[model samples]
Target: ERLGEREGIASLPRPAGRLVWVHAASVGETMSALPVIRLLAGQGPVLLTTGTVTSARLAAERLPERAVHQFVPLDVPGWTRRFLDHWRPDAAVFLESEIWPNLLAACDARGIRRFLVNGRLSAASTRNWRRAPGTARTLLGGFAAIHAQS
Candidate 1:
């Protein structure tokens, strides 16, 4: 079933109109993005991507009619490029701390407007990021706007 789900992602048809890609790494993120997905679907087609099969199932059940769910590809450069090229999303909205360097770089190179919603960094994670400040900046800078919660 998982393999079938992943394969289906590659076969998804491009949206007829504008496509907005929303990525949530797992079930919690998927649930949190539901309302936003619905709102975006009203404006244009929404492609919601989640990394977990459980989340995919939940998304399939709950997403609005105009929204479609897909499994997020692995964070390999080629795969990310392929996914982006196929989806051609007008904008990319990512939930929480699901930042993938290769994916963000691909999106940035494509000039896709990127947003980070409900972002939160743990104290330990912040300390870890501080150890690699350049990497942190490079990744976080990709987001046009970040709505973080304390």
Candidate 2:
């Protein structure tokens, strides 16, 4: 059977307890998250999501035991909804700065707790964020907390 032929996310062996949804923008973010993930998984399961194909592959190689890796769904409302519904994470953490409006809204609606780790507001991105304060504020407000890198 072709992958994704069915309606939802790929099946991985689900962990025994609570799951942490960690989103990484790329390889570096994935690597940086691994240690924290290990620490978190000591408490519960870890589900790692990455936007790029390469990052997914890297996570598959580097992810610790009890950590599952998968590609992140596009930020379209429908896809994000399906992805979240399937995974049903207890908490979420977005590495670096991936501010997907639809995804954040979905998380908010579902009442899934979320965090932004290693968040950096670069000078360029800060200026851009300022230009559209409403949109930026909406996205930023979704995070339960932000752990800035610097």
Candidate 2, 1-150: lDDT as tens digits: 313412336556556678899988888898899899889878878998876778878987888888887778776777788788888899999988788888899999999999998998889889988899999888888789998886
In the range 1-150, model 1's lDDT, one tens digit per residue, is: 445334334656887888999999999999999999999998989999998989988998999988998898888788888888888999999998988898899999999999999999889889999999999999998899999986
Could you give me the TM-score of model 1 versus the true structure? 0.93
lDDT at residue 147 of model 2 (Cα atoms):
88
lDDT of each: 0.88, 0.82
Error of 2 at 111 (Å): 0.7
User: What would the TM-scores of all predictions be?
Assistant: 0.93, 0.88
What is candidate 2's local distance difference test score?
0.82
The residue ranges of model 1 lying beyond 4 angstroms of the native Cα positions read 1-9
Best by TM-score: 1
The collision pairs in model 1 are none
Model 1, CA-based lDDT = 0.88
